[model samples]
Target: MNTDVLVVGAGPTGLALGIDLARRGVDALVVEKADRLFPGSRGKGIQPRTMEVFDDLGVLDAILAVGGTYPVGMVWQDGERVGEHRMFDPAEPTEDSPYNAPWMVPQWRTQEVLFARLVELGGRVAFGREVVGFERADQEADGVTVRFAAGPDVRARYVVAADGGRSVVRRTLGIGMTGETVDPNPLLVADTRITGLDRDNWHIFPPRGEHAGYLSICPLAGTEDFQVVAQFPEGTRVDLSAEAIRAVVAARSHLAPESVTEVRWASDFRPRAALADRFRSGRVFLAGDAAHVHSPAGGQGLNTSVQDAYNLGWKLGAVLRGGAPAALLGTYEEERRPVAGQMLGISTGVHRGEVRRGEATRQLGLGYRESSLTEETRTAPAGLCAGDRAPDGKLAGVRLFDAFRGPHWTLVAVGVEAPELPESVRVVTGDEQPSYGKGLFLVRPDGYVGWAGEDTSRLADYLDRGVTR
Candidate 1:
């Protein structure tokens, strides 16, 4: 059997890429080692950028309907409430954002959403199919032959190792993951229901000794269930026993120890930041944990993986259909590599703050306006840079469909003449109401700021960057 793209691992990244490819009428297969979906709330915070990606896939409303909105700001220190940060506010867009705030949902639920969409797109994940080896059809030619357990050899023009950090595909390709796995600190992670607690805010506890942790409580989307998170010293671990969880809850929430019930899931793991020197070798590409791994400081690990899949999906689809150049795939690494590097840096700072119990890391400093793929930064003001995710807002008198509409190339014309704009571009009048800002804007298929200007001088180049002339 063969496919256009054989994605190893059916996690969020692999499933997302599969869905995108299938939606564009490309043949792709997602092979997972596990017999069934992994159940648990590994990482729960979804970023604003990720929500916009969901919108592009036409599943944002369903995911949001299942997941509750977490609009409260974050607090510093454990239980001390030194300061705050807002999750979703209408007042943040710089005249061009498409999403007002991020949504909070469990990792498992996120996979469920993507999986359902993949099925709708005519792509199904082949579970219990493990990819154990890789072969080169030609030394210089970049085609790969993949071997799976108890199945015929599957030959593909391209293969992506969306397998986890400890990827067998990466190892088979002789790709070395160079980074430190050092765990000077260890922490326990658990998912359970705490009956008595305010579901609105994320509660963090004060620092304890050389180690620190927070109790994360958020409403599980579409249920009365509340997911809980508690951290301990690097050397400390979670005791899943009722008494253990109860004691921790009582101390953290100042509630009765018996109030904590239903110990659903739990685990212990250390944190590490590792990145592959290269994301692609020949016809094989690495994504998700296969390409990079970092601490879940900003809840970015899953989101980054999704973005990686998004970046590769369309390029792969276009290349397979002969609509775009193969070199478009090169931009995946060029764009995501630096983003991963920056994420590692920021996560390190976040962990350092948690370890030392220092003040919360300032979030305003975390923007990706430095990437070359971001045309907005080129035309942005003095302080602006590329690599940042585009912002979102609502248009007045527009139906709900128009609000979240468009995988099209969006151009918001300011004072510039709109009548002269090409028919290929979807141009909209700039929004200047109290809920929205004003400026010429362009959004990519994957929800990044592609072009923004007060004039048409840069519009030609911006449109050319995403598609072939």
Candidate 2:
């Protein structure tokens, strides 16, 4: 095998996994067909859930340095002031969690940050190298054979297909994406700089009857520009004519036609919500866009992809380091498939709900009930409210000596006797003896709280499962 792990496509998902593998001193190869990193901006908003993933990689602060913080959250009905929802603030951190706010950054910038981290960790992404083909010998000891555009066949013990929606790896393995492909009609998405429009908040408008139009406008970081996305009614041709776009903007925002000027960049494409039938086949695993594709309804496409990478990254590293079993890697599919399915259904529903009011928590409140690590917390009421990512609060003023200080297994103790601090466990306590309640909790390496029961003794059995010796 040319490498222990071969990751196809060097997008955010692949790079994130590569960085974690490199940090663990594992031999991993990240291959991309594109000659260079992405230059275009696709997804713009980075939710708090995704920030926690980056935090574990020790790149969250650097990402924040390049990204802008937008305290303003989602809006209802055409950017109307009414019915506004605010993102959780991070100013106050508790023992329960750490990241409480989302940051705004372009998808391209995120890839750049991950790539830099990968290089620093001694992993390099070979660009212009595509996995034209692959062949698996067996289920467990499968050897992935890949043919570069002009290079010779390269084989690896495992291959991860992060090759976007139309994944060649998935197709080669005969994996079908099973889901509804709604609203096939063309939609306009632009990453241009809007001069007259200036607002930190997300601007959205439901399409009105007859004159149908939708709008999403927010500021881009490190510049005086804003990313504007406007979706016209089905059958409306998205053209280069400035007059055409201005008319759509004016109609939606009720702004003067003359107020709109300059189109930095724009494109037209249809959005769909789809997920692969299976996340793994033989030794090849599918992830990110390759595993699932969905409408940018809640601005979830990019964030979901990054989150996918985060989930698989550590598992791959642990397995390669002989610290975990091969079955541990298989859990990647079992854990993430349902998540992608839920996200697809919820996000698409959120987009459609824009036209019609419906129950909206499915899109925003995702709690992980399928994970074995979260089984104890599943019955707990404090953190396991829904199937969304777990929320994080600050740790008042406790000090740890590392950069991303909370990577170790966190064992939070409450009224019950606290568990003995294992070598790899980080203990979060109060002024005196450890005290925990609704605000107190423990955090796993992947940022999920393994044990959330008020009883701290539960952690001993929880961590014993696989967290500690």
Candidate 3:
């Protein structure tokens, strides 16, 4: 095989998966059709759960340094400030959950950071190389061969399609997508530089009368630019040129046409939520937008995509390097397809004003409770259970997150007799952990609790299914 994994597309999902595999010492290659990284502030909001995933991938520090909290929304009408609107429900940071709010970092900057981290880990991306078609090996151990539009055919044990919604790979594999348009009205989104608006608040302008649409201009954190969003009529053709953007701002708000100085990037779309019929087909797997497409409403698209990579990365690594059965890779679709469906619903609800961006949008509550990999051995469970996220807290002298911060499982024996675990798995013994209560919590490499029990009778059997001693 040419490589263990071939990741198509160099977006956030592909780069993140590359970083994970490189750190695991897996031979992988990322190929992108574009000559350069994406250049837009489209998916700007990073949810709290994704922040935890970044922490594990070794990019949280840079992400925190470059991103900032979302500002309060300010309403305007006839050039007068009317009221202030809070974008998200306020939540305080607790010991178990340190990141309580959404972070603002342009999608372009997030990709750049992930790319830098991937390069630092010795992973490389081949630009301008697009996949035209691929075929699975006739024999299970022979691997798959992929043909590119401008390069020679490449072979790999597995291939991940991270290419966007219009995925040629998905189409070639005969996969169908099912979804509906979340909004009939066409919306315009742009990144621009304006002079008259203050950077302190997210400016909002409601419709003036029966004819006009609403406009919102938000200052993107960590950058000297603003993201402008406007709604148009059902069949109105949205203009994206710099002059057109300036005209929209001038006609909708108090800002003059000349106040809009530079137009960095602009695009138009009608919000839609979609999910692929299947996430896997033999040796090929679909992830990110290829598997599911969401409305940008609740900021779930990018966060969900990043978590998809995080979930699939470790399973692939374990199958290839940890002597686990190939069937372990099948759990990716089983565990993530339901999550993608739920997130799609949330995004659509937020778009239709049927839901609020509160606990659900934070994504900390999402887990794999119904997954086949989750083993809840305890007859009577307590605070935390299998498939729940292992909350972060100080246990004894070591932080739980510090112990769980790598590509390895963690056995946390809190106020219980510890068992002999595999050398590959890390152990943290503590007298008491407030969030976890008293029990044995087996934290997976992806930061979810894989098993919870009162004793170690079945722990060894669980380990035998995956990791080797």
Identify the candidate with maximal lDDT: 3
Best candidate according to TM-score: 3
TM value for model 3: 0.98
Backbone clash pairs in model 3 (N, Cα, C under 3 Å; residues 3+ apart or in different chains), count:
0
Report the C-alpha lDDT of model 1 over 1-469, residue by residue, as the tens digit: 7688899999888988988888777888899989987677777766666666777887888788777656464564543457665533333434444444556677788889889999987997998888888786542475668888867777777898999889998888788876774355665566677765666665555445544455655566555556666766665655767678778777665557777677777666678888888898878899999998878765667878888898888778757774566777777888788777766666665666533211112122334355555666233353323333444444444322244353344554444455455454565563443322355556555655555555566666665564521
**Decoy 1 TM-score against native:** 0.77
Question: Against the hidden reference, what TM-scores do the models get?
Answer: 0.77, 0.79, 0.98
Off by over 4 Å in 2: 71-98, 199-212, 235-265, 354-367, 373-410, 413-443, 451-469
Error of 2 at 58 (Å): 1.1
Error at 50, model 1, angstroms: 1.0
Q: Give residue 353's lDDT in candidate 1 (0 to 100).
A: 54
Candidate 2: lDDT over CA atoms?
0.68
Which of 1 and 2 is ahead in TM-score? Answer: 2
By summed lDDT, the worst window of 10 consecutive residues in model 1 runs over 356-365
Between prediction 1 and prediction 3, which has the larger lDDT?
3
* Count of clashing residue pairs in every prediction: 22, 13, 0
Question: 119, model 1: CA deviation in Å?
Answer: 1.0
Q: After superposition, how far is residue 228 of candidate 3 from its true place, in Å?
A: 0.9
Candidate 1 deviant stretches above 4 angstroms:
71-95, 137-142, 181-183, 196-221, 224-260, 354-443, 449-466
